[model samples]
Target: MTVVGFRSSIGTWGCAIGLIGLTLCWPAITPVSPAVALADEPAAAETPPDQPENDGSTETDSQETPSTGRTLEDAPTLERQVLTELESAPHWPARALAAIRLERFDCAPTRDRLIEFVQHDPDWRVRANAIRSLAERSIEQGEGWFEEEAEPRVIRTALRYGYEVDAGRVHRGVRFLLRSNRLDERLLGAEIAAASGKDDLVADATDTVRSVILRMDRAQAGLLSPRLSAMTGVRGLFSRQDWMRWFRENGRRVELAETRRDPPNPHPPPAGERSFLAELNVDAFARFESYVQQWPELRIDLVFALDCTGSMTPVFSRTQSIISDTMLFLQDITESPRFGLVAFRDVDQEFVTRPFRLTQDAEEIMLQTWLQEAVHGGRQSESVLAALHDSYAMSWREHVERLVILIGDGPPHRGEGGACIRLAERARTRGGIRTQVVEPINAPVRDFKEIAEAGGGRLWTLDDYVLILAELLGLERSDDIDQAFMAFIRHYTELLR
Candidate 1:
């Protein structure tokens, strides 16, 4: 197994390319930048090199973007460069590659480097890599780092890695992060709790998890004035302890416990209450004045595959309204998000808009007006199967979820919609893609199963469009959304019951 040893001045140097060798198979990571050679040069990210986050600041003062003139080779070339560079140096970037490689390899040096990075690395993402690297090694050693319990990202990374590489650790980590006030940390905790297959781990938080949460709570409160509401985000991160205990007492399956809906409040429903799902993701977005306020996860990409066909005229009209609302919603969110649009016709799908921030009122207005101009002229000869099968070519990205909401009501003109569904399935399973299909009632049920199964997505009938759209946006905390996610999990696990 290939593993990282340490960082040196000459970029990332590698000893063995044991497991990192597998990355060579991916065929895309070619043309890595030449080694900077010095101990100090601007790192590839926007922030300055190796600065710890403190005082509620996530970034450093420097905005040193990696030199962009360097053109990337195709996937295979990318893989060759990554493999060659990682094997040659133990610099930060090399260490990063080694960490990922160690996920497939393992050794004492790699483990130690990971531990050191987790404890001392200034970059959160680098630390994130260290946690992931350790978890991968834990696959064999079975004894991962118990010392990183205090860090939220470490805890979250542990939970994810644990579920895949070690169930017990994942179980423990989930509870630890759930009791964290940091929403990102807590949400990650929820994902871990939901993912753990072990009945005990899923059913009960370990003493370690409890201790971690308590310590984190204390840490957040300055280790002096322990407060109550401050604990709720962390506390509710996992379901109430009583709920878990009850699930254990009832001998419920871990899967069932996970899929079960949150309990209805004892308090009466407020009069004239409206379902968040009914509002539509495009519409509810209007509520957030800022990207951070609009969603718990900060990064968002809105991609619309609009149908340009005679039958889809009305559906396209609704698309127009959603587009307007989305533009307004963008204004509230952070400047980081990107919005893009595509028009699908009978023969092919094309990009009519580029990713731009809603922060620019002029840009948003132009975007909406552009959406109007393109909606009509695009021909409808393209097949839904063809449009999506080729989507990865246009919109794929790393570290962020890609949401492709297709508005249409028929089979693809090229390959069967079944092909597109299979492709979608692969993307979401890898956590790099998501697809939501909207179609008219009489379109076709045969393809619905394919899209839903492969894409790890939901297929909505236009008649029930409101319900499905809400679920897509994750707006309602209800049964439909619950089942929709159950479908989501089914994509991840084969033993669907």
Candidate 2:
């Protein structure tokens, strides 16, 4: 598939290659411009020959920078070179690449430059990259960016990175995207609503989805129906009147369901107490049951590969609960769904990878115990490749659907020779194991996305995982899954490719 187009001529692949080349050539490049050196040469004439050239920023001034203590002049040579590219690169792709590279550096100048690109870059791709860089640094511009940004791609980038959303901005952005003539943009609007997890916008988002489905042809509507199902949390409602009637009767219940699961709810009930499917009114529940009854009984084997490292400590409990809830929900829907788990940390840890074979034990006592016993003290980068490789050793069922959901926050350590990606490819080709990633918004996502793509699955954020899973598992036929995948690729081309 082609990369999504920005307002520039250069394709994404070309930009990626150019950026890689620039990184490789960084060390040999001159750090300072000759003009700046010439201007400072007279003042520094009295300095020792071995002394570094001073850029005139005081030490006190450096202390006040955002995250890093060094000014651009004192920053490492590689960072300085990337900063120069960001400032003076002629092409939009070069600037975009520079913005992405700058994410690793957290100094005042880098922050200022990224903010400038977010505000004034001519190309949307550059702005999107800059937005992601800022988000990675934990620098949030709040709802103001959402209110001011005109491009859906830019807004979606912010949304995907955990930017705080309020009622006012969501209402405005949802209305703008939903009202667009382009089907992709409209679908993105529904996506934005779903990602936002704002119960208040449910009515408007549901109404818009219903209206769009009614107007589009069957094929196009087939692509959009999942969004409606995701938003309303009820499947099998086809006609506009059916959706309207359901919403009128149970709209408040949908909002309440969202409230229960939304991340902001500090006191979320335990996994056993919450069930989105069970909470639906009797009629909606009956409809969903009827919808699933047509499908032939199928056997499925699932595995969860979780990263138990220091970085994941903050959200570990919540993540575990979500996975537990997911298992319960899947059990409710499917006839036979067996689950396994592989908890992993870095090589330096006591254990690199701990595996639990697939089992039909619905009690899930062993899985839950392992999940709770999983320790979290490794380095930032975990043994993801080891976990993936070990997952293949599981006794997967033959001629049945197999899935592996990798939940993590960091990439694999260096010098793994891309073994993790190769495992993903082999899983799809020989083992029939589809891989999906559930990643935190602030985590480095490119590698996880690659694994998912190789294993023929989609990468989902924690906030959107439930909805995406609902859509993915609810599909009755292969063609419907293909259409859903196409819609996903269309909306997320910038991130996926």
RMSD of each: 22.4, 23.3
lDDT of 1: 0.40
Q: Per-residue lDDT tens digits of candidate 2, residues 74-135?
A: 65565554456445755554465456545555467766777778767876657877776666
List where candidate 1 sits over 4 angstroms from the true fold.
1-297, 330-335, 348-381, 395-397, 440-446, 461-476, 479-497
Q: Total clashes, candidate 1?
A: 34
Give the per-residue lDDT digits (tens) of candidate 1, residues 327-413. 333323223445555555554334422233222232343233233322333342346665564454455445554676666665554
Q: lDDT of model 1 at residue 247?
A: 39
Clashes of each: 34, 0
lDDT of each: 0.40, 0.55
TM-score of each: 0.33, 0.38
- Provide the lDDT at 193 for model 2: 66
Lowest summed lDDT across 10 adjacent residues in model 1 is found at: 21-30
